[model samples]
Target: MRVSVKVKPGSKKGPLVETDEDGSLIVFLRERAVDGAANEALVKTLAKHFETRSANITIESGHSSRLKRVRIEE
Candidate 1:
């Protein structure tokens, strides 16, 4: 399955993920947009939310952008 995500970087309460009003997912990352920290955090959060392995989640688009398309293997 594929889902849309909008990331909010540099949050105070660690990483958080929620569904957005526009039908996209909202991801809040405590880490700044440096290296791949935020991306990794996103993956972890998604994995836990979907109750799947991190390996099952693949970033299909927007790797370096805030809006991301993630593919999850069921």
Candidate 2:
């Protein structure tokens, strides 16, 4: 399944929220968006959320933007 995600980097706490209108997932990362730290956090967060390994998650698009598309391998 393809899902839309909005990433929030440098957050004090980590949590995932769902958009009411679009149903996109909002992910919060405690790590700052530097040197791919936020991206790594995102992958880890998603992997845990889907009960999968970090390697199973891949950022398909928007690597440098707040909005991203992630592909989760089964």
Candidate 3:
């Protein structure tokens, strides 16, 4: 499955995930957007939510942006 995500890094109300009306996902992480920490957290959180391993999720696009495209391989 491929999903679009909007990441909110260093959020106080975070570690939360939700789906937008456009079918994109919104993810809030407590980690800062530094040293790829936010990306790592995104993968970890998505893995847990999708009931898959982190290795199965790949960032397809928007590596340096808040909006990201992730590929979840089965």
Candidate 4:
């Protein structure tokens, strides 16, 4: 499955996930967008939330942007 996500990095309001009316996801993360830290955290957090393995998550696009497309192998 593919998901459209807007990531909020280095946020105190983190550890949260919200959905928009467009069916996209808003993910709050504590990790900053530095050296792929936020990306890693995103994968791990989403993995737990989706009840899937972290390895199954892939950032298909927007590797450096806040908005990203993630592919989940389910």
Candidate 1 clash pair list: none
TM-score of 3: 0.97
- Superposed by TM-score, candidate 3 places the C-alpha of residue 20 at a distance from the truth, in angstroms, of 0.5
In candidate 2, which residue pairs clash?
none
TM-score to true structure, per model: 0.91, 0.88, 0.97, 0.97
- Give the alpha carbon lDDT tens digit for every residue of 1-74 in model 3: 88999999999978899999999999999999999999999999999999899999999999999999999998
lDDT tens readout by residue for model 4, 1-74: 99999999999999788999999999999999999999999999899999999999999999999999999999
Determine the C-alpha RMSD for candidate 1 after optimal superposition of all C-alphas.
1.1
Off by over 4 Å in 2: 15-20
TM accuracy, model 1: 0.91
Better of 1 and 4 by TM-score: 4
lDDT (CA) per prediction:
0.88, 0.85, 0.96, 0.96
lDDT of 1 at 27: 84
Of candidate 2, the 10-residue stretch with the lowest lDDT total is 13-22
Candidate 1 total steric clashes: 0
Instruction: Give residue 51's lDDT in candidate 2 (0 to 100).
Output: 92
